[model samples]
Target chain A: MSSTILLQSIGFGITTAAVVAIGAMGFTLQLGVTNLLNLSFGNVMTIGAFASLIAEHWHLGLAATIIAAPLAGALVTFVLARTLFALFARRQGGAFDLLMVTLATGLIIQYTIDALAHLQVFQFSFPSGSTLNIGPFVFTVLSLSLVGVAALVLAALLAVLHLTRIGKALRALSVDPKLARACGVPMRRMINLTWIISGALAGLAGLVYVTNSLTVDASAGLDFLVLVIAAAILGGAGSPVGAVVAALVVGIASEVVAAVGGSYYSQAAGLGILALVLVLRPASGVWSGPSRDEVTV
Target chain B: MPDQLLRVTGATAGYRGVPVVREVDIAVGASEIALVVGPNGAGKSTFVKAVIGELPLMSGRIEFNGKDVSGWGEERRAAGGIGYVPQTRDVFPTLSVIDNLEVGGFRLSPKECKQAIAQMFERFPALERLRHRKARQLSGGERKMLAIARALMADPKVLILDEPTAGLAPRIAHEVLEDLVVGLAKLGRGILLIEQRVTLASAVASHVTVLVDGRVSYAARGDEFRAVPDVSALFFGSGEAAERSSWSAARGPA
Candidate 1:
C-alpha cells in the first residue's frame, strides 16, 4: 500500500509540473522581456479562468471558451502595461515602485472578481473522459492532455521567440533599450507585443489549472502563484527551458511531501526551495533585465 | 560642396530642463568632417545628445536634409539616416560582432544585410576573423572598430561619433581617425566627431568648434585653426582670461 501511494504521488507530481511549467514560462518571459515583476500575474490568471467560466455560462462551445480565456488575459494585461505600468515608468520609477504597482493591481483584480463571483467556488465540469492505467500510474484522459497542452504552449512560444524578427527585437530591447532605440527599433510596439504574448500564455495556464482541479474561484490563481513564482525564481530569469526544469523539480518535491504529510507541508517545501534559491543567487534581484542607468535612457 | 545633411541652431538642452549645454550651433554638410573638442565636463556629450534628440531641446530648431526634425525622436533620426556611435557601450557587448552588425541592418533584406556585413569585414579585416566573437571579448580598438562598422551597416548619410577614441592606444586611435573617419568622409557622408585628442583630430577636420562651460568658445575653419600654435590652450582653460591668453596669445583671432 505504501509503494502504491508513492507511485500515485509521482503521477500527481507530473500533473502539477505540467501546470507549473505553463504559468512559469509566461511569468519568466514577461519578467525578462519587460523587466516588470508583475505580482498581479496571479490575478491575471484568475481573470482568465473567470473569462472562460463566463463563456461557458453563456453556453459557448468548448473551443470558444478555451480561446476566450487567453484573449481576456492578453487584453487586460496589455491595457495594464500600456496605462498603469507606463505611468510609473515615465516618472522614473525604480524596481520597487513597479513591484508595488503590480501588487496593488493584483489586489484590485482579485477583489473585483470576488465581488462578481460572490467568493464562492464554482464546479468546473469539463468531461473527464476515461481513466487510463500505465504501469504503476493511473490518470484520467483529461489529466494526460494537460501535459500535452503545456508542451504545445511551450513549443508555440519558443517558435515565436526564435523564429521572428519581432522576437529578435524583443531580446535586444531587454538587453539595452537605448541601443535598441538607436538601432531604429519601434520601442512601444515591441513592448506591447511582449505583454500580449505573456498575457496570452497566462490565460491558457488559468484554463489548464481550472480544468485540472475541477473548480474555479477568485483565489484560485493566487493559490497557484506560489508554485509559479518558485519555479520562475529557481529557473533563473529569462530562460523558458530552465522554468520547465525548475517546475518539474518543485512540482515533484511538493507533491511527494504532500503525500507524506499534508497540503501545508507541500507549500512549505515549495517556499523553502524558493528561499534557498534566493539565498544562493542573491544577484538575481528584481532588476535582472536593466540597470538604473540604462532604464532612464 | 554637397548639401548640409544636419543643422543645429540655438540648441538649448539639458537634463530635466536645467540646461547643461546652452545655445549650441553646429552644422554638418556632406563630405565635411566637423570636430568638436573640449575638456572633461565641457558638455561635449550634451551637445551630441542634443543633436541626436536623446535629450529634449528647450528652444532650438534642428534640420536634417532640409526638413525640420526638432519634433522627431531619436529612433526616427536614426531611421532617417543619422548613424550614432555613443562613447560607451556603442556595441552590444553580449552579442557577437556579426550579431551587432545584423541588428544595425534590421531594416535590410537578407541579401543586402549579408552584402553589408561582407563590406564591413573587408573594411576592418581584424573584425572579419572575430565575427563570431562576442563584442565584450574584443580588445578596446577592435570593439571601437566593430562599433563603427556596425553603424556603417545602415548606409547612413551622416554619422555622429561621441568620443569614439576616448580610451584607445595612440596608435589605434590614429588608425580610427585616419582610416575610418577620413574614409567615410571621402565617400561623401557628413561626420560629426567628438574627440578629446584635439591635436590628432585637427589634421582631418574640415572645421573645428571649441566648447567650454556649455558654450561654443571658438569656431573656425581647419586652415585658420592650424595657424594657432597652442590649440590645447583653447581647451583646459576655465575662465575668460585663460581662454583669451591661450589660443589668442598663441596667434591672432580668426
Candidate 2:
C-alpha cells in the first residue's frame, strides 16, 4: 500500500481504536470482575445514543447529548445489575449463565431502542464539519475530539484504578470478590460505582461513534460490540491498559485491511485476528473460568 | 469473665438439603484457643463454616457477643468483629501482599488501613520484605501468614482459622501455628483453631474440643488433654471403650 494510504489508515485506525477502547474498557471492567460476557453491552450503548438523540431533538445541544447518553447508559446498567444480574449471581450464574442473561438483555435493549426510534434505519442530524489534514492523514475535528475524549476517559480510569483507594478496592475485588467483601470493601457500593462508570463511558463512546459516522440507528452500538469483545479478550480481561493497546492493534489492522480490501470486509478482518489470537493462545482463552471474586458487579 | 464469647446451641447446617455438620453445641471464650480435631468427613470444616456464616444454618442459633447472630450475614458478622480465614483461596492472588492486607482492613479509612498494614508488617516482619509480591507467588506458609494477617487487619475480636496448615510441610506448619498463636494472642484476638494433629493441639492450643461425627467427644483445656495417655488413639482410633479410657486417663492424670 502507498505511504499516504497507510498514514490515512493509521489516522482512521487511531480514531476507531479510541472508540473501541472506550467500549472495551467498560466491557472488560464489568467482565473482569463479574465474569459476565454481556452481549447486551452493545444494546446499552445504543440506548445511550438514543437517549442523546432524544436530548438533541429537544434542542438540548451537543452538550446535553453527551451528558444524557452516558447517564442513560449508567441507569440502564444499574437497573440490570441490581435487579437482574444480582438475582442470577445469587443463584451462582457462573460465567456461562451470566452470558446468556446478557445476551437476552442485549436483544431486549436493541429491539426496544429500534421500536422507540420508530423503526427508522437512519438518524443523521448529527453535525460533521470540514475534514482537516494532520500531516499526510485527514479527519474531521469531530473525529479528533471523539478520539481526545476517549483518551481522556481511559487515562482518568487508569488513574482511578491505580491512584485512588476506591480503585485499589476495585482491583482487589475483581481478583477475589469474597475476600474483598471480607476485607470490608463495601462491595455493593463499589459494584454500583463500576456499573455507573462503565455505563457512562459506554454512553459517551456510543455518542462519539454516531458523531464520526454522522448517522446512527438502533444497531449502532451492536455492530461495534463485536469489535469491542474481540479487543477486550485480546487485551486480557482484567487489565485496562491492555485493553487500550489491544484496541489500537485491532483498530489499525482492520483499517489497513479496509485500505486494501472492500469496506464490508474490514470488520471481518478484525474478527479473523481475534480468532487467530484465541486459537494460538490457550492460556488467555476467554473460555476459561473467570475469576469471580474480582467482578461481582 | 463471662462463660463464652461465642456459643453455638444445637446448630444444624449444611449444603443442598444434606447436613454436613449435624446438631452441635460449642463454646469459645475470650483469650482462648479452641481447636476442633476430627476425621476427614467428620464435619469439622462444616462446623467452622456454619459459625462464620459460610454455610447456612438448617436449624439452631449462633450467639456472638451475647446476641443471636444466626440471622446475620458475613458482613454483619465481620462488622460485629468476627474474622474468618478460609482455607487457601482466601487471599487475593493477583493483589500485592500489602494490597491483600488492605482488603482485610476494609472497614478502616485509607490512612487507618495503611496504619494497620504497617502494624501487620511490623508484627510479621517477613511479610514486610514480600509486601510488593503478588499473593499467588507466595509459598504455602507465606500464603497462610498472608491469610491470617489479612483477617487480623480487621482487628476482629474473634478469629477463626480453618485448616490453616493443611498443606504445608511439618516444619512450616509448626512455625506458622506458633507465630500465629503468639502474634494473635499479643493482640488479644480470640482464636478458634482447627487442626488434624493431636500433637498440634497440645503444642500451642489453650483449649481443645474433640469433634467426632459432628459431636464433641471431649472438650477441655489443652494442658489437661496433653497429660492423658494415648489421646491420639482416642481421636484417631475406634472403640467406645478406648474413648472412655482416654477420657478417664485425661481426668485422672491431674
TM-score of chain B of each: 0.91, 0.88
**Candidate 2: which stretches are off by over 4 Å?**
A1-3, A90-94, A124-136, A285-297, B1-3, B236-254
Worst ten-residue run, lDDT, model 1 chain B?
A: B245-254
* lDDT string, candidate 2, A155-184, tens digits: 998899877778878988777677676666
Model 1 B-chain TM: 0.91
Best by lDDT: 1
Query: Clashes in model 2: which pairs?
Result: A33-A294, A33-A295, A34-A295, A40-A106, A173-A294, A174-A294, A175-A294, A177-A293
The DockQ-based CAPRI class assigned to model 2 is: medium
TM-score of predicted model 1? 0.89
Model 1 spans with C-alpha error above 4 angstroms: A1-7, A129-140, A285-297, B109-115, B121-133, B223-227, B239-254
Two-chain DockQ for each candidate model: 0.53, 0.62
lDDT of 1 by residue, A225-295 (tens): 88888998888666787788899998888988899998778777789888988888777633353452433
Give the lDDT of residue B149 in candidate 1. 89
Among the numbered candidates, top DockQ falls to 2
Deviation from native of the Cα of residue B91 in model 2, angstroms? 1.7
Residues B1-254 of candidate 1: C-alpha lDDT, one tens digit per residue: 12878888888888876988777777788998998988888889888887887878998788889888998999898888989999987887766788788888776787998999999998889999998898889999999999898889889999999988889999989998999899999999999999988888988998888888887777777776777888777875654633332322332211
